[model samples]
Target: MGFFDRWRGREQRASIEDPRVPISSPNIITFLGLDAISASGETVTIDSAMGVPAVWAAVNFMSGTLAGLPLHVYRRTDEGRERVKGGLATILHDAVNDETSSFEWRKHCFDQAFTGGRAYSFIERSAGRKVTNLWPLDPTKTVVKRESGRKFYQYKDGSRTHRYDAAEIIDIPFMLKSDMLQHRSPILANKDIIGLAQAVTKYGAKFFQNGGVPPFVIEGPFQSPGAMTRAAEDLSAAVQKAAKDNRLALSLPAGHTLKQIGVDPEKSQLVELQRFIIEQIARIYSLPPTFLQDLTHGTFSNTEQQDLHFVKHTLKRWVEQFEQELNLKLFGRGNTRQYCEANVDGLLRGDFKTRMEGNARAIQTGQLTPNEARAMDNRKAMPNGDDLLIQGATVPLGTQPVMPVPANDNDEPKADAA
Candidate 1:
């Protein structure tokens, strides 16, 4: 069947089987659910987890960094493959750039994939069977269910419901396991850390607001009826006024002794506790302690390596997931040769002098043509720049015999007398 026809069929089938609708059969029932809880009692969800600074930093940093990257599409041929444009490339590069920029779309995709373990986007096609636009779907409201070995998506958008087949949606799942149905969310896996972080944040806030006040016991020798009660009330009122107005003094009646109590903030080790919690939260998100502005263990040389580690160890997996999903779903089945790749060279690029030296070396070693190397620096190519030049001393690795050169006859003119 054609793409649109198959889509229509799936929609009709999904509508008929949709349990949300009122059907004559009494056995039918719809189970509306969303995965929003973790092992802890806290509500561990994408939005909630983002409230934690560490999580927000991790998600925002990754999404924004990846979105700024360039995702290029290439078509494979018998001889070689070349970068393609004006088809899938154009669609992905600025898909709905007028309303939703490509960077925003990519950021959303990465954010969803990282926090929820899956990201989804609805594919809009034109009458010519070309994908015209892409729209992100909230992973929380969208449900992925399988029936009769066929997987489909049911999305709840406000009052209306949208159904899409596997072909009509872009699914980027992270850490997909043997279930082959869904991916495990990193946020969910580290719910305890998130809860503790939030709890510590709340404690810190309360600590600052009430830190000046110290608990104490009021003792007096008043033996009259309601004397102790009246004294306690007056003392409470004075303390409250002092605390609320930031007063430095509190009056006490004669023969009354005030004993200070409660643990001090320093004695409680709140700073150390908070630091430990931040590091743990950072670890949960696969972020180095340094990235979260915790430079306790960071060094000058190690910082550069840490940045590289962030790109390679952490960000590469997310980038590859996006590339593979776009290649597979955007190009459709049987188009295995054509694929998309996010150019991450920008992230790994060095300083200007270092970059120029590396490019020059590449051109000299024939690894890249002069024109190609110049293009890397956004410089125009020169005449004959396309020619690949190699060092005169370098040749194929093999044994060769040297040949003798013949002498010119003009140099033997001195022997004419003989």
Candidate 2:
């Protein structure tokens, strides 16, 4: 049975009002938020996970970086490959539909993928089998099933259900389960770590919310429980009043003494713990610590290396996955001529000096025409700039330079000794 089907069955069973049913049942736990409770005792749902600054930064950095890139469709040709323009290319590079730009659509898709562990988009094609538009689908409402060696997507939308062939859906999963149809959510997989971060944040907030006072106990002699409770309330009022009045001294009765129950944030190493959690989050996303703005150990040289690492190790994998998925679903498995690719050159567009030097080297090595290099910088091409140029001073190692010979033997220079 599908997840929602099982959920409905549980709901129906829970509605029978049977006193024998345990409160710890799945439906009860889900309704009471117990299912979301993490090891640290913090509820770590998708929304709560995003509340952590480190997670927020990691997801936005990855998804936004991908969305900001330019995705283009290209065609294979005998003379290498050429970019395909218009039609599907326009949809991918400019706008997926009238309402959605390519960037927004890509960002939304990746946001879902990074958090929910899967993203889906519906490919709308014309009767002629040409793509016309791309529409985003909610991963939560969709279910994937395989039958007879073919996959199908069944999406529930309101009172209607839409079924689509696997070919019609663009599905990207963070990681597939054993069945290959269900996916493992990144947030769900590391809820303990995220929950710890959440718990620490809440602790810090509550600490400050109570005027920077830790939990404390009053040690005093009291004849009755009511007397002790009244004395505690009076002490609480005094502390709050002192804090509000900005007074340095907290006055208490002679017999009453406030004993702090827990260590201060500094003694508890909260700052270090937070930084460590940031590094853990970075690991979860395969990102460098610098990417998460945790530069405690970053130096200039390593920071530059981290930039390269991000493009090569982290971003390249995601870019390739997205490109392959696009190619497969949009063009089909048998397609060889048409494909999609993300222009990640923008990711390395760092300092102007560095970019200019790299472009110059490419031009001088005959790897790129002058005009092609100019296009990278958004500059107009110069006349005759289309020709590839190389340094004229260099020659092949084995070949000797040609020397001019005299037209006749008489024209040859004689040795001074002769």
Candidate 3:
């Protein structure tokens, strides 16, 4: 029996109705603000932060990469594990594809996980406790609450509240909280990084506005009040016009001086600062620096390693969370052996030549059989290919026989001839 079936039976036995309907209490949605305000006083919400290029790039890269992956269902039995087929696999692999839903399942998961560090979906069940449809929930409005050590989800929509038991709701969280019920948002944790990003943008703008020079002071000899005012205004107008016209020359009157005051962007290391910020953002998302297109320290060999690292470190974390959630909700907790998994090997696989060479080595070394290697290339197996083969010259260790001597007859004949 499924988790929902067990819960439903208990509820019926206790004569307690499921709280699917809204209560008579006032419909006041409690506000649990992130309080993520930058040092520059900019309110950093997911939407606003996404407007920043670095944040947008990182988030989009992660989401798009994860969305393109294929999720598979597998079953483990006494006969050994095999890819699952039929209803469950169909739902995970194809039914959740783009045609059945407004958005692709992967994309839906990406948006929720990236923005709020959590993704929620409802499993609509039929009369027989069979899943009829799956729909995403707005992570912003879905609240997780625990009472008497039992956790439930409450979704506030306009003036109504939709409640769901843990079995009916799919909650994929990025990282767990202390209570293990709510998730922690990445965006909220690193407001300082976002603030620094804002500063970098502001600095770049000012650099251009000042005609590629930092702020400076103009000192001139004493003059009549009217003359000084007129001279100052004239210099200001000329500099402003030059800036607009992209002119490098700024002609000033005699006794008037333009001394550049602030440190140049190069000398002040603004470029390095920007690069560092990119790396920091990448780190927060557990992505390699190259994934963010920051190749300051990237090399040919390191780039390949980092790609593998991305699949292993970054994508694996998210995929594992998804697998466990799919197993618990879709397959039910009763079936401990059957589970869903993301086919991360697609991302981890190497180029054709490299992969073929590695597989050849595996076969030659007796690590893999011929049919096993063929399966990786999507080719049909040949007869007798399942047998493991090793080079004929090689013998089993400690099993070589000693050759007997045949010199007795030769020795007697040679003795007579001498």
Candidate 4:
């Protein structure tokens, strides 16, 4: 069962009644907002002019969407509206609302030029050259002719002369948030898809120091998406209360006593005990998933600029695979995959699996099979023939391998007698 109905009325959330309605199994849409909340390092921002519709969307999300009260909104565009397909993906941007006041923003008003029509024209002649490749910056040179008094000084042959526009100033913005779409990097055409990418890419680009090498930092305007978390907490609380009234504990996992894992403290008897346990675990381990999903590949101009699929699936896979991987470490060695098995043999300490259950006595004692200790491991191993969709085909790997070569193995040893 879902956390809350997140509905305004009967017309809204009937489709999302199952939480997994439009999504695949093991996926809970209500958790998306929460997953986004928990994710770290990589983040995208949304800023727009005349944001009334956008603001309306945000408020709707906060009020009911994530609270398990599935409400209907336009998730997908065009003919898809008649059906309750997917809950329109809602991303919380703390600064999107306040962006208008911060900069010399550009805006498009419903002009008198479109007098008889309700829509703006897409056929208008453009100003700046169109930028096709958005990444690593465009190399096109925009020259400004020199003209005024002391506008820019030119120094040549040890002599300094007052000259105008002597220097060509290049502006490179891969990702950015600007009020004016025209001012945005990539010089937005429609100010919808490309614009959003410009802002996100510009902002995302800044976090990379020394040219996107290592240590990709999260450069934030760390605005909080209070609605997403608040909704989850409220729903959890409500469910908790219901459980308590019925005298039921959230779950009785091993090593936890009934008293320690007492009945929930919220107020919704409608939730299922199994669902509650999973949801709670999800809440607790939220960071290991959404925070890690990378939306670097897909772009605003790519797919209605909808990032929900990319972000949601990426996070879900990361969490599921990561959890299974951690479990594999508990068994350690013995018939594990070449890489996985080596990781557990008291070697490969740097692998993420090492951080999972390395110190557990069960793993150290070798009392369990690599697959048995972590029941989830078997599913996550390198895909065998049966699992591959295309038989006999192998997934490609980078020449730059995922695993590191030991420095000792890489070192050139001194010449010595055999």
Candidate 5:
């Protein structure tokens, strides 16, 4: 390999897409779904907990966030695996890190290329090789030390079968394929004169899926189940209280507020009770608008962070004030977190209309999906009436029907595969 050829090989590897690799199904589904949903939710790529695709859902938690980048890699028997992987990764890693392609964008591509981080199915035709930007979960690096008797180690890729530990060429089911193993399932994972340790193999699988470079532990997912549940529950309760608290915060008239009609305002906590009431009254009687700028009013980082209680209290205070002054009903909580209707409608001073107009323009300009357009229509009570079967996409629970979404005639894309 001459210096110039090597240099050209490196230079040839920009963010250019490899023509050889076939797009995996997982990759297609994620990117398309994200495009559809983003239009519907009016959400950008950075929203937390917004799993545009299963890319976020694939990882247990925070690692999912980091995994949003497309990892360019070249794998195969071309005797250029290391060089190719390194070269491609260099351009891709930098491009992604610099946000030339946003985290969401790279993630979108990865899902398309690897079928949602399953397998790096790179098929070769002639004296060819396989390569991809994605890999099995483990992709873990390893060091083997032959301590006298046996030789083997486990692979860690964060799948059930990643538990294979052997000094020899161990085979395991790929996450994408989930059926066969590259080598063997239960390879050697013995310590000292040790034979096989199931736990050892499991550890290897974990190490591989997350990352094996330095081999670190990812404990964040432990809190995901609990924290997500609590956050949802807490937010639900707080919104319900916003009616009364909102009125009080805006100092609106209580007689017009809805909370006084069914429940006693005095029974609730001072801050919370006040806020909800204010919000409700403000809504009923049409009050002026307020804005929320994400301001860092303080200097120190060690101070108490904002949590459920603080949010609830703040909501309550705003609602309570509105009720005291406006004497109107406002702010009801249920599935969606909505602002006070009347306050929003009247006090918006045509801001709502203007925003809607802009949203419409965005839609007309090839930025919206049918589902999104339908949702927007439903919001304004302007019926589009296009509900075929169910709302939202399919949930993965092993067995379920996956009917293809009807594509538009005019805008229907010429699918590469079909």
Candidate 6:
């Protein structure tokens, strides 16, 4: 089936299986009924987990940042490495296919990886064995299996099953299980943390929904269980009415006394708990809390350090993983001359002054030519900027300059004497 047709079918299937619709199959019932339940009593599926601000922020931050990076293909030359511009390079750097831009393709793949634990793309090659396009496959519908000691990707498209060789698919898993073929989802693996966040948020919302009142029990003289229930219902109505009327106090029967049963949000430290959950989510993605918008402990200096930490530790790891996977699948294991890479120089573009200063230093130190540095900022090169330059005063450390000898003291007077 065509991509859009398959997507439309999937959407239709999802709509048909709406939660409100009843299902008879035990498996479907269980899947719809008991999504990953955490100790905090919150359902922690990918959709519910994403409802938590922290998880949403972390996933979007990582995936969007990665997708925004400049990806390129390069060839190793006798002089140095130079970027390859056509064919596969164009497919990677611009559009994976005529329908999708490179950014959207990468973002979709990474969004799957961050949320579902795995991302996959089918690489289409022409008769000449050159990559023509990359089509993303839904991880939920794609299964990886080993047959005859060879790995294969089986993708389910409606009623049809399409199979591809492992080399034809680019697979990135958040982490692998012991079986190697199966993967572990970050959301499923750390559902408890995400669940707690959801639970806390729900609690806060319900608390406010019911007039900012903590759950409480009524104590008084009651003749029967039914009477106690009636008294409780009356008090609940009174509380809601008071809140609706914007009253500061709630009236109760003379003999009945109300006592709070559950801990208040402040006492339970709900805000602190939320912040901690954000930190935990950040940890799951190897990101700093600052990236997730948890600035409780973010200082200017440490946040700057965190930016460096993110690039060096988290971003670089994923970049290398993606690069290696692309190189292997696109060029084959035997090919080494051509490779793919993510250029991270754009990450520093936000700090214009600092970036320009660093580029100037590189140019002055002969580490980069003027034109090469200009290319980083997407500026046109100067006519004479191709040459690598260094400070004129810079010389070998131990070398001494030849000094012109001073004329003898009497030599200046020789003309006058004549």
* lDDT scores of the candidates, listed in order: 0.77, 0.89, 0.77, 0.28, 0.32, 0.89
Tell me the tens digit of each residue's lDDT in model 3 across 279-312: 8888889889888888899999999999888877
Q: For residues 1-418, what per-residue lDDT tens digits would candidate 5 score against the true structure?
A: 9998887776544332543222443334333434323222332232221222222232222222223323333333454233233433453444433334434433343332222222111111124321123222222233222334554434434453332223122112212233222221110110111111122234445433423222212222334677646644553344445543552222222332212122222343433532343333223212211211112232233122332232244333433342222121111223122121112222223356665775566555556544555454345423553333333345679767868988787896668975
Q: Which candidate would rank higher by TM-score, 3 or 5?
A: 3
| Pairwise lDDT winner, candidates 2 and 4 | 2
Q: Mind giving the per-residue lDDT tens digits that candidate 2 earns over 30-112?
A: 44556578899887899999999999999999999999997888889998898889999999999999989999999999999
> Candidate 6: minimum summed lDDT over ten consecutive residues — where?
20-29
**Clashing residue pairs found in predicted model 2:** none
Which residue runs does candidate 6 get wrong by more than 4 Å? 1-35, 396-399, 402-418
Regarding lDDT, does 4 or 6 come out ahead? 6
| Residue pairs of candidate 3 with colliding backbone atoms | none
Q: State residue 404's C-alpha deviation in candidate 2, in Å.
A: 10
RMSD of 3: 9.9
TM-score of 5: 0.17
Q: lDDT per residue, candidate 1, 3-72, as tens digits?
A: 9988666554322546454443222321221233434446565677788887888778878889988777
- How many clashes in each structure? 0, 0, 0, 29, 89, 0
Which should have the higher lDDT, number 1 or number 6?
6
Better of 5 and 6 by TM-score: 6
Worst 10 residues of 2 by lDDT: 14-23
User: Worst lDDT window (10 residues) for model 4?
Assistant: 101-110
**Residue 250 accuracy (lDDT) in model 4:** 46
Per-model TM-score on C-alpha atoms: 0.78, 0.88, 0.78, 0.13, 0.17, 0.87
Per-model RMSD to reference:
9.9, 5.4, 9.9, 30.9, 32.7, 8.7
